[model samples]
Target: MKSTLLSLLRTGEGEFVSGEKISDQLGCSRTAVWKHIDALRKEGYTVEAAPKKGYRLAGEPDTLSVHQLKSRLPEPSFVKDILHYPSIHSTQETAHLLASEQAEEGTIVLADEQTKGKGRLGRQWHSPPETGIWMSLILRPDIEVRSAPQLTLLTAVAVVRGIKESLGLDPEIKWPNDILFNGRKAAGILTEMQAEPDRVHAIIVGLGLNVNQDYFPDELADIATSLRLEKGEKVSRTDVLEAILKEWDWLYRMFLKEGFSSVKPLWEAHALTMGKEITARTPRETLKGVAVGIDDAGVLLLRTKDGKLHHIYSADIEV
Candidate 1:
């Protein structure tokens, strides 16, 4: 009901809509309409209510909610179901629970802040309130467990494409999952999966994108940056999210039809690690080498100075 009222006011686009008209359209009393408008204001919507003019939506807040995001999405199929939280331990953990309960594909678990947010190799992701995009997408892909890692690369490609399209910035992909802007980290992708040996269950792709932060903490000051910091102005998080979903939907369908072979070239085009001297630190050991490229299974292929080729299944790369 609140969403409906808000939508009506938004459709008015700063013009006043009478309380009587709102009550007639929503089949509610003027008092109820006034209550809903009050609620909208409380949720950071600047709704103006005059004596006779009724109400007008003056401004929107920079917050992520089901109402705001759904209103911005181009199609319902992009996000069939969305779970929004003001603050949470982790969107990835909640997404896993929802997927286990048979949540539909394209369902999203989003939060303004994540208390226990994580990145690859179990590192903590910095997700401050209302300044970054902390969301997990639940995907049930019909592929083998060995092929599941390819989705991470595909997601990186989609994110780069989305950022380019929305912000007009060409961010570079740092091998496995980091998105960099001017050599500083802008986003990270963590892809986890549940599967049998031969078949797959669900893949949860978690994305943490710094959007509107003015500055990072001392620990992250050297490496982390936000869209606003890069662009020198605030960019719409809704627009970035929508672009990502559209790119994800498009690339996912392409991957399904043509496999990772078709998607690998696109990922390579925006890659920052390729053809660069780097060090890859895995669980067992670290190796310094020139990053040749990715192999057929999307593993990083590193050519060491000793001229031996190494396949990296999972590693942290430093360029």
Candidate 2:
């Protein structure tokens, strides 16, 4: 309802939209229209109401909103739609359910906080309220199951470019998923799939980015960080998200048309793990080696101490 009301008001940009017209269009009472307008004001939007002229948008805040996000994108946006939640268990969880029910491709699930945020390898992602970008993008790509991990690399590049553009920060990709500044974690990508043996249904990519966190809990103090922590000031979450979405839209089209060949160099340029000796902890064994590079299929190629190259499909990388 909020989104619908926003759309109506936005159609008459730079002018007032009458309360009677809003109620008629929304199929609600005049009182309801005023209440919704008031709600928008409380969310930091400056909505000016007049006696007979009705209401108009006076200002917009540096916050997240479905209406604002949609306005930022191009018409017939590559993003099919974005489902926004102020707070939820996990955007990835909701994305999985939506994708399973045959949601359209390019749909995004966005949230301000996640009570039970998810991470890779059954880990819990810490998602504090209003301080991060917590969102999941659902993709139904025409690619084989073996090529899924490439999307993770693709997303990492998008995020790196996004942060660099938005905050003037040089963030690097810690192979497979994490984005880090210096050595502390700034963001992570968790990719989940609904697929068959040889086919694919949906790829839900969840990104948790620490945007304006002033401090971390004791456990995360040493290992975690945020853009604000690094920049000595606050940053807008919506600005970063908008930049990422634009980058993702461009890269996704290129990926679908060309393939990983185009994305390899971009990922490698921002990759922090490449050419470094690292320890990898997989489910079966622990291996120590120098991180070489990822293959065409997005598999990490590690050259161990004994001079043998190993194909690592899944692991926790310690650099």
Candidate 3:
């Protein structure tokens, strides 16, 4: 009911909607409308209330909520169910639990801040309050466990396309699942899966994007940056999230129909490590070589100095 009232105020277009009219439209008492308006004001929304004119929405807060995201999204089916939080230990953990309970494929777990966010190889991800995008997507793909790694590559393609479409900035994919901008880490993707020996149960793709953050910690100051820092202004998290979901829906559908071959070209076109001398670091050892390309199953290919080609299934690439 509060969400509906808020939506009505926003759609009022800067003109005051009379309290009687709002009550009539919402089928609620005038006092109930006043209470919701007060709540919106406390949530950082600049709602102006005039006794005779009623309430008008002057401004909105830079917060991510289910209602806010749904209002902005063009396609409703992409977000069947969204679990939003002001703070959480990890969206990934919550998403895994929801998936285990048979949540729909397009359900999302999103948060304003993550207390224990993580990236690939168990590295900590910095997710401050109300600054970046920290969310997890639950997907139940009908693919083999062997083909699950390709979903990471698919997510990278969707994120890059989303950033391009929303901000008009071209970011590069760093090997498996990192997005780089101007040689700095702008976003990270971590893909986790639950599978049997041959079939996949669910794949949770977690994305931590630096959207409107203005600063980072001393440790990340040298290597990390945000979209606001790159764009010279604050970018909308809602727009970025909407764009990514739309792109992911389209790309995932194409991948399901035509296989990974259909999406490989786009991933390679924006790949940053291709044709560059780099170091691939796995848990066992590190190898220095030139990145050639990805194979049919989305494994990276590297050519060593000794003219040997190595098919890297999992590693962190340093270019």
Best by lDDT: 2
> Poorest 10 consecutive residues of model 3 by lDDT?
70-79
> What TM-score do all the candidates reach, one by one?
0.82, 0.82, 0.83
Model 2 CA deviation exceeding 4 Å by range: 1-62
Instruction: For residues 277-311, write the lDDT of model 1, one tens digit per residue.
Output: 99999999999999999987799999999999999
- Which runs in model 1 stand beyond 4 Å of their true positions? 1-60, 71-78
Worst 10 residues of 1 by lDDT: 69-78
The local lDDT score (0 to 100) that residue 21 gets in candidate 1 is 88
Per-residue lDDT, model 1, residue 310, is 96
Query: How displaced is residue 189 in candidate 1, in Å?
Result: 0.8
> What are the per-residue Cα lDDT tens digits for candidate 3 across 1-319?
7778888887799999889988998898999888888888898899998989998998887877578777766664556788999999999999999999999898899999999998878788999989989999999889988898899999999999999999998999998988999889999998999878888889999999999888889999989988889889888898888888878888898999899999999999999999999999977889999999999899999999999999999998899
Whole-model lDDT values for every prediction: 0.90, 0.90, 0.89
Clashing pairs in 2: none
Instruction: Give the runs in model 3 whose Cα sits over 4 Å from its true position.
Output: 1-42, 45-60, 71-78
Residue-wise C-alpha lDDT for candidate 2, range 1-319, written one tens digit per residue? 9889888888878699998899999999999899999999898778889988898987665567678778887766679898889899999999999999999999999998899998898889999988899999999999999899999999999999988888888999998999999989999999889999999999999999998789999999999999999888778887888888888888899999999989999999999999999999988999999999998888899999899999999999999
